[model samples]
Target: MSIFHLMLSSVVIFFVLYAPQPLLAQFAQLYATSPANTGLLMSVTMLPLAIAPICYGLFLANYSKLKLLKVAMMLLALCSVLITLQQRFELFLLLRFIEGLILPAALTAMTSYIGQTWQGQCLRRNMTWYVGSTILGGFLGRALAANFATWWNWESFYIFNAALLILISLRIKLPPLENITTPKACSPKDYLRPLKQPSLLRLYCAVFCMFFCFSALLNYLPFILSNEYNLKDPKLIGWVYGGYLVGALLSMCAPYLTKLHNNNWVILTAVFGVYCVSISAMQWQNLGAFIVLFTLFCACMFIIHASAAPLANEISSAHASITNGAYVSFYYSGGALGSFLPGFIYQTAGIEMFLLSLLLICILGAYFTWLNYRIGSETQLGR
Candidate 1:
């Protein structure tokens, strides 16, 4: 039951986090903004996500996870309701920024709560389910948001999301914080300390590029469909994100893939190479071709994410939470920038040029993976 609630928490947080993505095209038109500028709807939320994990790890080490989770969810629900009433675009962005600040606390609390409550194989199993729930949340959030917009109005989805969040906040349960042992509080320097490790730094850089490309493609995809393909209906636009489910399944397969290759970095490099190929194939003019390739694109990206996260912990077990926190920072930092910056290329140059930019970034990611592999091999030989 606790695990069920934990997974529910995972799903709702992610649902709230990404619910705005499919509506970017609609938001751009409604707010009277350029496609490039409209990207801020995502970037404003992501920027806070990129920075907040470190603070949570450093300062909230001993805080009550259940209390934090409940408060964050309730506040996020309020933000969702406020977004429904917001008329000014700037205030809308401000509300998104506030959502960003609140999200990390919910995420940090849920993950920490898991560590506190479980151990060994039980812990691994729960975490895997947690990851799956987040993927489900991401997919359902986009799919439902667009459909809800088409069925009624854009604000309808937020009203629906707010209701779910409030229910989850009031119902989900967790062990009391006093029952869990408190970790030693970390200092600010601890946050920067992971940057000094070469292998960890290399992994961080690779994931940044990986997510940068992923966010760029997903964030701007609706514009391409509506503007280029002349597919304006939000219901059909939402269906395109059906490819997201492919990612959820592939995430579960990542551990098996690691077993098939002895050098994990080799697998990482190859997976990224495949990602480059899939996105390159997306340059085809047909929407069907784009959707098929997008599915492959999603599969490749999640495999990289599923593999990279555990590797970060393996590389630095002593400071596991901080390492993971820094990983989130770099990953979403790429997302923050990728959510907006690629809009200019897609807007001014075209989709071909936009994809070309992401291809170059993936190539760089592959290089970083190779660097990590080489350094790890050298360290092992020295040992």
Candidate 2:
């Protein structure tokens, strides 16, 4: 039941969060903005999302998980309602930023809730489902909004999601849960001490590049496909992102793959290689082949995500929460920058250039993956 509740939390958070992405074309037309400006709408959510974990540690550390979850859920619904009602484009963007601030708490609460509810292997499997479900939610959020926009309007996402969140909040239950709070006496140096470890910092760098590539590709793919492939319909564009479901399913294979492979980072680097190959193939302009490669790319990215996340969280047993939080902060920072810069490059240069940029990001990610593994192995042998 806790897992089910966490999945529900994931579905609604992601569903509302990405509602604006598929509508970027419409937004540009409505607001008379450039591609870069419209992309800002998507990137804005990630900005505060990146910053909020540090703030959470500094100020909101004492808040209970259930209490924060409730506040976040309620405010999320409000943000959705406001977005739905907002006719002014700038105001809408601001509201999306507010959603960014609210989101991390709710998401953090969901994770902490799961940790409280389950233990050992049970905890691990449930966490995997948590990841899969969030990925599914991201897919559905965009897919459903785009699909419904044809019948209703762009605002339909907010109207529908606000209602869903309200419904979920009304019924969801949890036992008393506490945040993995830093003790008030925990200083900045103390919190950051784990980061001085070479292997952990490598994981941080690797995950940042991993998410940067993933976010850049996902955020910009709609624009490229719509403009280049002559598939401009919102509904059609939304369906293209269904490739994310392939990633979600592949993420489930993480546990098995790590079991067979001696080093998770080794598997990660190999997967990154496959991911780069697939993204590079998008240059072929063959729709059938493009979709297949894109699906493979998604698979490899999520597989890396699933493997690296647990490794980052477990790397510092004494400060697991801080380690996890730092990784996510890095992840969202990558996402914020990736979402913005690729769109700017795509706007200024060309789609070819954007793909070239993503290829570079992917290759760098693979390097960092191997670097982390190599350093960790040497440390073990040296010991």
Candidate 3:
């Protein structure tokens, strides 16, 4: 695929994945619901996000990646439009759920396309753009919805996304992918084989922990800021989210960082170590202190996600597609769990307890990273 096509594809992917978050608070207000219940809007989407990848991994084993992506994008467009029309909570949630199902196919196709066409620095550059697009989409989607409420309505966000999707569909030219036919029959038991590897398992656990922590913050940060900080300006919310720009820059730096040292070390030090410090700093209510800490936290998260994603792909080279699908599935499943657990914990205990819980989870993720490093080193030595 051309560079333009690749960039366009990434934009579409990012918008589809993250465009729902800014609207969550709005949805809650409209429905007269709690933060916990508003979380269902996201939780519902994650269910399909987890399930669709596995099924598509199997079903699309013999299909063309470009064709699959086109279909998936079309489905996503339709769903975005449909979501705008729904007035009832049940209908809204159901449409989001179905939207999730369409995501895995598009995501899988996009990843496979990039993997086949680019490698080394080229791949990393494209992936960075992909990450940036996600950050941009998320920030813009929410900012636009909140800031422009007077201009149109909340549905304008969905409409804008739908229009962007249509433009991408018309312009991007995707390359054909390899078709896996007459493949060796791998049973469900076989699919579980990657989990048997200690390195892979550790990576999976780290992903679960990282996403769980990140999701909790994303789901609750608005409420935290509004309630605790007493900030009512939607534009301020958008600017605060602009902290992700720092993360986007960090993700773009991953390839260079990996060249200097092992990615596992990067994950251990940046993700676990710095992230913990940043989260701990959140206790200080000063605006400057909060911004600095939040920026550091996001930067570390970008480092971890960038490093670990490629490592997940490397863990099972033979079944790269299936392995990637599985990794994303786990990643989002953790997100779903993260979305719900924080609210439950906060309701029962308090925000202090909830944040403390996240701190502990980060420690566990750090431990897993250390173990992964040792195992990888020993295996290399033996070889």
Candidate 4:
């Protein structure tokens, strides 16, 4: 039952995360706006994603995780239906922003539930399914948009997602809630202490940098492919995104990799190498080479995300929820920046220069990762 609930929760998240991509083109057409403005559609949702986790972490800390999750999923379903009916861009944005608040709450609840219910190999396996569900959601959402658009309309995509949510809600039996104090009941000063740790600070920075790279690529890749390469087929774009499958695989393998050596160093080296290779690969105009490079980029991204999430929690120890919230806020805040910054870079500088800038950020990320590793080792050894 726990596994079923978890899978259902993952599907909900998958739609939440990936459903917006195909809709970007649709948003552009519906609003008669530029790609840059359509990009803001995603930014609007991400803004709340950046803010809500912290607020929820601090304020709703004692709420029943299962109850909140179930309610959030229902709210998400309602929001999706409402969003589907909207013709005005501003209205759609408003719905998305509200949905964003619901999403982080759901995420927090889900994480807490997983922590409470599972441990060791079970926990790791569940997390792998979670990550895979995210990628699968991305693929399924895009593929549906691409193939089904001709039969129905863009709004049909939301309808489909809503149906799926409803089904999950009906079938899943979430675990009973345990009695606990809400994080909100804690003083503001209590939340601030996690930032004092150098190791935690480094992890926060690393998450920010990693998301900056991943989000930039995700936001701009479609535009680059469509405008520069003149690829118009949405199906093809979905195929390109299929590279995320490699990411799902790599994320599942992360535990094994960690057993082999220092997970931090392995992730740092992979991130740095991926950034350098991606920048070079972006120069190639050929479709085949583009796919290969993008796949490699996606793989590296999953490794970073898979490793960083747990590391952030590990560093926070007693304050895992607050630290996790801080980590998420910084991560998505970087994503919001990445969404818009790449457009500005593309306008002012060439694509290669934009890629180069991301490479530099990746290098900084590597440095921070190493710093965190050394600090963590010292702390452990001292104990």
Clashing pairs in model 2, backbone N/Cα/C closer than 3 A: none
Tens digit of per-residue lDDT, candidate 2, span 167-258:
88866664566545456545666666656788777777878887888888886786778888888886677667777787679779876776
In order, candidate lDDTs are 0.78, 0.75, 0.70, 0.70
Sorted on lDDT, best first, the list reads 1, 2, 4, 3
- Candidate 4's TM-score: 0.87
Model 1 lDDT, full chain set: 0.78
Q: What is the per-residue lDDT of model 4 for residues 78-196, given as tens digits with 9 covering 90 to 100?
A: 99899878878888878878877788887766665554455554655565566566666666766676566768887787788888887887665645656564344357677666568
Per-prediction TM-score? 0.83, 0.86, 0.86, 0.87
* Runs in model 4 lying further than 4 Å from the true structure: 31-38, 120-122, 172-186, 226-237, 262-272, 280-287, 376-383
- List where candidate 3 sits over 4 angstroms from the true fold: 24-39, 85-88, 147-149, 172-182, 186-188, 266-270, 378-383
Sorting all predicted structures by TM-score, with the top scorer first, yields 4, 3, 2, 1
Total clashing pairs for each candidate: 0, 0, 0, 4
Worst 10 residues of 1 by lDDT: 374-383
Assess candidate 3 and give its lDDT.
Answer: 0.70
